[model samples]
Target: MRHTWLICGLAICLSWGTSVRAEVTITPDVVYGHKSGLAMTMDVFTPTENVNGAGVLFMVSGGWYSRWQPPEQMQDRFKPLTDKGFTVFAVRHGSSPKFSIPEAVSDVRRSVRFIRKNSDRFQIDPQRLGVYGYSAGGHLSLMLGTASDDGDPAAKDPVDRVSNRVAAVVAFVAPTDLRIMVKDAPDRLDAYARFPALDLDLKAAEADSPLVHVTPDDPPTLLIAGDKDDLVPIEHSRNIQAAFEQADVTSRLIEVAGAGHGFRGEDARRSTASMVEWFQSQLAP
Candidate 1:
């Protein structure tokens, strides 16, 4: 599977004093939460100038596998958002095989809550946080957007006392219904079926499924899917979009005609632009 770093072509300009520059500073390994003695971390990207103070989280997972890349690589991967003055957090969760999808979901939720609690430290508006990603990463984004909750006032952890809700979501070819995946899992010959992430049974799949929890208050979501995608069909996005509509939530699904699970070239560029535009509109004051 292609990691979603095919977006270097996106041109994002940052206004500086008297001149424009696009330099970004990365704060790496910022621990948001801990899981079973392991640190759940995110690398923060801040534009050198013209900071917008709106934060966007980039879900960095493929097949529920979250690993660390050098900070310099993130500067390339997240430059578009950073250059446009959005502070970007590349969030990594507890990976699969060792951990289940439910665990991954919990990790991301904790990450969001931690980030929200410390929003002032990062100079971001807690109300304007957006999340985006592709594949399993996209699935995680949907989970965040749809199943958000207000803080648990009685929770022991301060992070759990802050809401994990987000303002916007842009998920690329994400698997929306894990129940459907679970049903199809027996017949799947793909690499995804081999992964322990999709090892969930019916009950567990439904619990982690984003489509199951969508409500009117969920974030405005923009789902970009490939019509030719058989791995996670475009129907996944279509079905979720219909649910969003029924709930009177703002949502849109863009089906790229000839594209598959992963977009390329023009498709990639346009998809990214659409993501940026969605965030700009939804995160606006």
Candidate 2:
């Protein structure tokens, strides 16, 4: 079954087990501390029956597009797990330009906290959380999975106590290394302003990059990218996998032959299937 939140354009696709139906709540934009605000909200797909405690937290792409429409393909992409009994939370966050990457990253982090903080009401297993995304969304998912605990400890809200860490991450066509990404991707740089202009020095780059943060403690990651991707270069994902290897963490890089950044047509569908399988194997209870 497919669950959707109209205002936020969040969509959760349930496949393996029945999706719990719940009304989508639109919480007003509130700030996390003094920095990140609640311009973002989440759609919880609760199974109608007493929830069996299965679920995944998802973030959709928010690049340069005028509207942040959750791709229909994503719903189809995640159906495999949903069919098997995982409730999915399709999360929506404020995008670039209006907000900086740090701000957006904080918003994504806040969304995870929101879901876990209210996991009981949503009937989801907080500890069983997994995350997935595409393009910029994929980048955001990686941020949540990688930068889970980097938040400030001085935050006052009780929800700030919630951990944003995810058990697994599936990122499609994400630029793992922002330094190389800015050097090689002018188009994407134009899409998300400030990011490319930010410090690209070694120290700053490492701090801003997911690959640099990779440690054995990080959750297993599945990186999918087109070998011929012109926009974000497949090397970006390759570099990230290498970092994972150096850290002795589990990482898999699936290169779709002759495919571009977005993996159009049949390739897109196939990429989505691979992501579903990865999530199922890593996240299923």
Candidate 3:
């Protein structure tokens, strides 16, 4: 995949004695892989003052190929964190057919390394990094939390040495086990099986599972899921919470009664509030 990084040349000319305005840098569509030819991108939001010591957030969205752009609601969704002195990074990763879940996971790891390498320039405290994602994105956040530290010491890039481990993770309706997700996907199971491009080999699916990678050292995790979620079984979080308990890792789960795959009405508001609270408690100095 060949991707062009288009910085939307919005020029700024500050007058004498004027304050500098906040700016966002979008490294649009950079190819991270050569085989699947997959690429990813980021839209980074920075605070105008004292961002150097602030927390960092990498926000990824759910989409197997659709809904690649950030939802309009997310702007306000992110404001609270940024206002509280955080730098938010909205990332885009390749999804399905064009690439598999494993490939997408690798892309995310690469994106984290890229961000940490440039953290000083972005005024980010690399140690205070966090990840927040919804649906498929949620699963990716878990992967980053659990399986990110497998290092390649011989890698040429110095950024590769920076650990991909996050300080915390905020997840919504994340699928922990692919095998269970495949078995439980009511209407979409057949469609997914028929789609050869999905390339879901049993072994590969298990290998890509976030639940399979949990350890005692894993970071604190907050999971929010609807009890009636059809796409992601409620057992996904239940089992993960169970594992966390066994490992003595800090974890919490909030199941919204009667809520479906995604939250609705007040459910959405409460869920977001819980997530905000969790991140604040864990990521704040």
Candidate 4:
């Protein structure tokens, strides 16, 4: 199923070859943040046409791990946004087994600040920023929506002084509660074990959980999950959706039937289409 999705994604990319090259300008390897001498970078994709003045930060992460994916590899996932003239920032953070989840979270926050601080240069409206990701990246996107902060006036760094808040969030197959997710999926326990701090500190893990921090001020969120998922249960999305409703925040959860941890074929296409429409509704100018 995953292989079929990859083939379809590749076909979509190939179909868009001429337009992608002519309508999008990709600036790769732009340093966004740094931690412990390691630089976190993002590939910025600006549409050369239409110019909507909106930005969507794409967290390039899975299982709390991150790496730089070439723009071509991401063309299918981000092309819908670019076609509508939204600039896409493929943000990469430090990986786990070396850097913990807390560190990775910090990196994502910093990336938000960095993007907002330089919004003018990127030709995007800082206030219209949105974020989306799948799996671990989805968790991070929720964190940004619920735990964002206004820039400190006294901060020495100008970037740190800018707000990290986003206008909207879209999460796919994400675990809203880390403790419950890890407890429920014993077979996938090794992924969380890579973060030594999380293994030793229960409170820290809870603090990082998105559902624990959601408030009324959180941006409108759209959560997509598979009803048959055995890895991260569908209950995770339902719980978060209920929490958002209690807080008076707009939230929607779409459970794809017969799908597992990953969506493929029709499910995959529907998921991507829903994400694009959600962002357009929330962030389009």
lDDT digits (tens) for residues 148-216 of candidate 3: 984467887675766677888988887787764453434444534633324565677787788898899
Best by lDDT: 1
1-285 in candidate 4: lDDT tens per residue? Answer: 431211111111322123338878777778887778767788788889998999999888777767655667777678888988889998888776577778878889999999999988898999999999888788889999999899898999888899999999999888788775443444554545543434425567787899999899999999999998766778889999999999999889999998877887898899988998999999967
lDDT of 4 at 29: 73
Which residue runs does candidate 4 get wrong by more than 4 Å? 1-20, 181-200
Best first by lDDT, ranked: 1, 4, 3, 2
| Distance from true location, Cα of 87 in model 4, Å | 0.5
Query: Once superposed on the true structure, which residue ranges of model 1 sit more than 4 Å away at CA?
Result: 1-22, 183-191
Best-to-worst order by TM-score is 1, 4, 3, 2
Give me the runs in candidate 2 sitting further than 4 Å from their true place: 1-38, 47-52, 64-78, 150-154, 183-206
Task: Give a tens-digit lDDT track for model 1, residues 187-250.
Answer: 6546455567888888999998899999888889999999988677788899999999999999
Query: Which pairs of residues collide in candidate 4?
Result: none
Question: After superposing candidate 3, which stretches have Cα over 4 Å from the reference?
Answer: 1-39, 49-52, 55-59, 66-74, 182-198
* Clashing residue pairs for model 1: none
Residue 143's lDDT within candidate 1 is 97
TM-score: model 4 vs. ground truth: 0.89
Candidate 3: 10-residue stretch with minimal lDDT: 1-10
Write down the RMSD of candidate 2 (Cα, Å).
6.7
